[model samples]
Target: MEALEKSREHVIGLFRVVVGLLFACHGAATLFGVLGGPQGAKPDVAAWPGWWAAVVQLLGGALVLCGLATRAAALLCSGSMAYAYFVEHQPEALFPLQNGGEAAAMFCWSFLLIAALGPGRWTLPSLARLRRRPGTRPITRTSSTSSL
Candidate 1:
């Protein structure tokens, strides 16, 4: 059981590393206009400006990938998706048929899971052993006048 747990932890830690890198890529795309916009995808409206939207998505992705603020990042991403869904995708309906917000939905779910389970053991946060400390109590000897 312990072995199983260790393997699971390592797997999740690796998962976070991959996720973080991916998020960084997406963030860079938005920040630097690699994919499309100078600020990534932006809803066409008088809504929030494209620059702020890009920052929100990019930052959330980074946090999720880092596992430093998993829940918070996940919530932000999820909320972004939800807002996008209603504001954009809902009018058109589901995906494939319209490519409607499905990708965003998946992103939401992935981050949500990450938020719940976290990056697992072997992560930088847990690897230091700083929180648990080194050892327990020490044994001491008593000086008695008895011979054995």
Candidate 2:
């Protein structure tokens, strides 16, 4: 069981890193038109949506890779993809694959895992700090009443 748990951690860590980098790549491409992105796309400026996408992709992806905000990033990006697929690209399924729902389903599942599991113990939250709190209760000893 312990070994299996450790394996799961390793795999999840890799997933965060890989997915984060890829998302960041997309964000960067969309925002700055860097590395030959869409021509004259004029990335949406309202709410700096493009920039936000870039930041979220770059920073969030990094956090996921480092297991810092794996769950948070996952949940956020998952929703983004959902909106894109259903709202924006709703006319048909992904470009290929017989108009199937494969990619959308995969995205949901991946992000769900992130939200459900959160960044594992290896994250930056400092577990030691979690163990100690200001309002901890004191232990009490019971015996014959006072005067024993």
Candidate whose TM-score is highest: 1
Error of 2 at 65 (Å): 2.3
In model 1, where do residues sit more than 4 Å from their true spots?
1-6, 35-49, 95-97, 127-148
Q: What does candidate 2's lDDT look like per residue over 6-111, in tens digits?
A: 7886676567566666666666676667766732365666445445655666566666656665777788877766765565445675552544545555655676
Clashing pairs in 1: 20-65
lDDT of 1 by residue, 33-92 (tens): 676544335444334645555566777777666666667776777677667666766677
- Candidate 1 residue-wise lDDT at 113: 71
**Once model 2 is optimally superposed onto the true structure by TM-score, how far is the C-alpha of residue 97 displaced, in angstroms?**
3.0
User: By TM-score, how accurate is candidate 2?
Assistant: 0.61
lDDT of 2: 0.63
**What are the candidates' C-alpha RMSDs?**
9.8, 9.6
